[model samples]
Target: NALTPPNFIKSIIEEDLRSGKVKEVVTRFPPEPNGYMHIGHVRAIFIDFALADEFGGRTNLRFDDTNPAKEDVEYVNSIKEDIKWLGFQWDNQYYASDYFDEMYNRAVLLINKGLAYVDDQSADEIRENRGTLTEPGKNSPYRDRSVEENLDLFTRMKNGEFKNGERVLRAKIDMASPNINLRDPVIYRISHTTHHNTGDKWCIYPMYTFAHPLEDAIEGVTHSLCSLEFEDQRPFYDWVVRECEMEAQPRQYEFGRLNVSTMVTSKRKLRKLVEENLVDGWDDPRMPTVSGMRRRGYTPEAIKSFIYETGISRSQGLIDIQTLEHFVREDLKLKAPRTMAVLRPLKVVITNYPEGESELLPAENNTENEEMGIRQIPFSREIYIEQDDFMEEPPSKYFRLFPGNEVRLKHAYFIKCHDFIKDENGEVVEIHCTYDPATKSGSDFNARKVKGTIHWVDASSAVPAEFRLYEPLLGEDEESEELAADETNDVSADEVDDFLKKVNKDSMEVVQGFVEPQLKDAQPQDKFQFFRHGYFNVDPKLSEPGKPVFGRIVSMKSSFKL
Candidate 1:
């Protein structure tokens, strides 16, 4: 009664089951393990696994590792880890190489049936003869060889007698079909390359089009869902399935791929970026790759929520990257605890307060999570405020510190600035203020209202640390262009290289900053809100004992106003 729930191929599967033509459903996520899976693949994997689960069917994780020259065991492991991280487990892990022997025998069957031939033409020559979209392709001169001759040559190819790229086995499909995939597609090619799994046993390897359907049929997949780009290839895929004489005859369905703004997603292009050192690695936080997002603190739940909000439309669309960040903020707001740290320090001396005296101030761990409880912050005579908090000559709307102005030192005392000292470069170095002892925080005497309540770090008891401010990898205009041509992916492969170029010239400006002494014992991955500045988390890769590096996740607000 589930009726495959209405998508193209699924609807067919549902109808078949209802009509007693089939009993169960089966689907597969077949990724070519040449590189780390990107955010786009996340959607495909979820759809493949979820659809089968919904219909009481099974899903297989199949590696289309036909191109051994590019595939690696590293990618295979990463693929598995990513799937498990997303909370999906495959019924079985299958590899295209597992059917190498069967695929070879099937090729022999086609040759014996006089439906395929061995072509000695080079790759370039084959492309030249394939013709354009407007014209029909020409058949190979060797296309008319006898079945015995083709079979003998193919057998020799299997025996590794031919060098790499010397010859290829092509199906005897139509050259006049408008769909170029049907133009006698290449079924087997000489690679002479050692595979990650089957090793050098395969000098002649099966092509993706030839290997994928075999993988599905062998695994008993009833619906083979793929992207819209493969729509034209479905006919050829079906032809090969029929020629191979599959009993189940798995159907192919197409859907639009996930495309996001500000990033390029092609594996080849991403690899180029990595090779060219345009990025740090595949998992660079700037990359649109799933690994990159993970390192940047994105949760799988947030990613899934973004996908759901984007909706599943037949028409291809590009979603703004900001939409993703929005969901991340929404999720973390309720989950992450809040703390305070100063990025740029400016000294403030309380002239009226007794020297060397300190008090423990109570601060909320997270206003959103009261159960997290309160933490004690040490406050003393000499403290450090944000450098931007005080100006000798402030603008009319600037509510912070200036001569004769009163502001509340957050969670402590109200102070009135009287004087300031500056360095030779004219930068405000320090400020002198008078604190109202009667106006102690959390007391009935703290009745006086102030225009601003600024965060402060006790200078004598503060911890010295590194604060990293991250900006978008590229500017709005440049990122827009990169997103527009994702299919042509000329951007970063390793992203670190591209990041070096696209870095906001002032992306990371080092400053002498201070944090409350309580953070001195904080370890990596510990997150905090820098009071009025922004939300941040410790940099796992950069932080060290006694020298912590904090990465700014997002500011308290979007862009700063003048």
Candidate 2:
């Protein structure tokens, strides 16, 4: 458990502790709880909880459930489960809706101080008037409304008098602030939708930026940690806390967000994949979601190690997906037991061996760890090897099961291909070979060696299982193409429809396979290293009591050095 040393956040905490500027470091992970958590969220969770742990402080898990229109209990529960599975716990759990009463009264206080006004513009109108980076926003005609009228309108809006988007209360900040977020941002809006937490009791909900800082102050959170995208909103965050007269003040800090090449974590894109029947579900093995990775058999330790290596910084850089796979291989190398599986089963008949004769062979459970002990595998005359292991006419240096060639059958005996069967299509149906008993594995009579060793399973004892191979979830060219589309300022439904074409049709490849008899009772989430194939996990959704579906976690190769 070698932790990342002395990064910027760590340095800040150390200095704060030394200077006595902060007696107790308190942090919180406030997620909007609208969708499933993705890999980018890993950095925030680790930093928030890890910082508190290093400083002898506390961290709370808070759900910023301000907009109930898109939030649900399923997402809320899943978020909590993902955080727990990531090896952390919350000191206290709170929701933004839990303080609706206080938030409502605080809005009244802003109105009483003549620092706020109610605007009757529609959502589009507000956005239009909010202006752009170069232009100053125009004020609403109702901006000069008296405090008494503003308070009345806000209270009535809370009583469900206003329709969903009729009117919204705005903080009376400068309309021409250079920082656009400070220009009279919306503080409260009327939403008729029932909330997962608050139910139908309240119709007026506080905006995220407005409620976020208030929630932090109420919880006495000393540090409000979030991604760099919220940097522009920091000013408004401070304004809400200060104007509402909250006693406890928390400072907000930003960090670079993690991104992976060839994978898009955008909620819009992910939801498209789910809604259009492109992916199975949120826990689809190809997805970057925590549950998806967990279902695919990615160990928490591997994810944490990868995150540590990535480290915290102010600038975000794209991480190649291979780096993540390398960590998985690194963590599972010494843990997962080695076994043989033939994904595309090709029958191999050992003509020289006695027919119907099966015997048990000993194989190391894990070559890197002796304490894991050995597992017995059944070997017989008729066995199954990978279809790709044999070639009728292999190129030069090819030593596998071609005609008139001798090769080793991993942990078994040397087999020389003598004949083969073919179907009407002229495809190799089965391979016929003769075994050399003297060259049995672990035998001291080693006079020669073959160039290649392939894995196999006994035909009689091979358990039928499904192997799911995955490519990049995003199409090879979709990353740049989609970014280009964004730059064109196209938000039409037709533009969104083009996403289906951009999805990687080859992302998931399912094939029937045969595993060793030892894997007969392999349960869901069980992991094994298939020799020459890669590490795989028993898929929970598709796996049954006797038959299991294995999801390829990562192939057993890497270009990553560390």
Model 2 weakest 10-residue run by lDDT: 481-490
Measured by lDDT, the strongest candidate is: 2
Candidate 2: tens digits of C-alpha lDDT, residues 86-185: 9988999988889988888898999999999999999899989998889999999999999889988988998888798899999999989999888898
> What local distance difference test score does each model get?
0.78, 0.85
For candidate 1, write residues 242-344 as lDDT tens digits: 8888776788887777877656566765676677665668876666778777666677777877766665445467777778878777877766777667778
The reply for model 2, stretches above 4 Å from the true place, is 1-5, 476-496, 558-562
Clashes of 1: 16
Worst 10 residues of 1 by lDDT: 480-489
> After superposition, which runs of candidate 1 have C-alpha atoms over 4 Å from their true positions?
1-22, 438-440, 444-448, 477-512
What is the lDDT, from 0 to 100, of the residue 175 in candidate 2?
Answer: 86
Each model's TM-score? Answer: 0.89, 0.94
